[model samples]
Target: MAASSIANPRSDTANQVWTDLSPLLQFNNMEIINVADGVTSFLIHPEITTTVGRLKHCTFMAVLWEIWCSRNRARFQGQDMSAKHIINRSMLSIRAITIAANFQKILQPWLVALCQSNSRNEILKVLIPKVVRWLTPPPGRLKMNVDGAFNMTSGEAGGGGILRDHKGNMCCAFAKPYHGLNSSLSTEALALRDDLSICCSKGVYEVLLETDSLNLLHIATR
Candidate 1:
């Protein structure tokens, strides 16, 4: 409940914040609990005083603070911030704190490297790559992109596909919700089958099928 006070009045805000931060600040299964529970557990553990543990603990606090501040800014000043922006700001703040206190001993090698970079432009250049344009299908051929997602906790899977012409105009799109999927491979296979069936039904003989699953690709080609 580290930032519970800030989110008490807005349940939706709390959900959004959690959704954005969960992937960035994952904890071990035993350490996964309410924010207050996790914080208390960390405090009680002797290892929490170690250099690495202390750095991680401080990082968690900084990220929580950044999330609260970003929420307030969005609510009052009409300025919204992305999760990436919050993380970047938190890192910079931690770097500043480490510098002021001369806490280099506790800093990780990666953190030391980040601090040494100093230049925002250099960091950006290293972190963000140039965008590339999507390739268009050859003339007379339709392009189909299919993907699938599996939720381990829910034991459910979903798949979707989109078909576009050579000019990149969308011709058709489809999505399906599946339950009790054994694995991601099954979901992906189902998606490919459905997408290809749709194209066949539409009289599309020539197609450029694209999928991220190497297994599926190999299966189809073979």
Candidate 2:
């Protein structure tokens, strides 16, 4: 269908999607990850993430529910975002389904129903909490405790942690906004040292403390 577009642009704008421009058709080797039995999530290999993936793949997830509405303009009548409603009216479209399929094959009707397009402090108030909840592992699920902070341009900082069992569930969480002022040498050292202090205070005998700073690990251990 799209192949016919290059030669005949004005001739066919209805009934047939010009195959050539279809994102699915253009990106030949891209693979979609199966997240569940019926759901799919596709990540453009990192190499392409900065390009087409950023443009197309990212769009579908951003304001997924709202876009789902807009894409189905005829059915939805208009895109709507209402905080009080908890759920908005939307007409699903082929475009929306394709986008969902690109991300994960399992597009819950509820997710498609409540997803909104706005991304701001106000929206984050509504969105981030939900995302965090979704990302939170269930009870007894294995989870990692991670934290980060900035001290000097490259110096001492504070950190946080959370404990979880084998099921990706977070058993505990912790954080400290500011550790102290130090050089690059003491930044991570302070974080690790502080983490240890916290563990002792809370009586956490066994847990994982994760950090991205190599220098801190070295200093804290020594």
- Which segments of model 2 are wrong by more than 4 Å? 1-57, 60-146, 151-158
Best by lDDT: 1
Query: What global local distance difference test value does model 2 have?
Result: 0.41
Shift in Å, residue 70, candidate 2: 25
Where is model 2 poorest over a 10-residue stretch in terms of lDDT?
83-92
Q: Supply every candidate's count of residue pairs whose N, Cα or C atoms clash at under 3 angstroms.
A: 1, 22
Q: Mind giving the per-residue lDDT tens digits that candidate 2 earns over 1-222?
A: 222222222322211221322333232211212222111223344333333344344333332343333335534545342322211222223334434444332233423333423321222122222111324445533444555666565354666666667565555666665645655445445556666666667676655555667766665469
Query: How does each model score on TM-score?
Result: 0.48, 0.34
- Position 121, candidate 2: lDDT: 21
Which tens-of-lDDT digit does each residue in 64-89 have in candidate 1?
68878887778776876666677677
For model 1 the local lDDT of residue 142 reads 82
lDDT of 1 at 135: 83
**What's the true lDDT of residue 155 in model 2?**
52
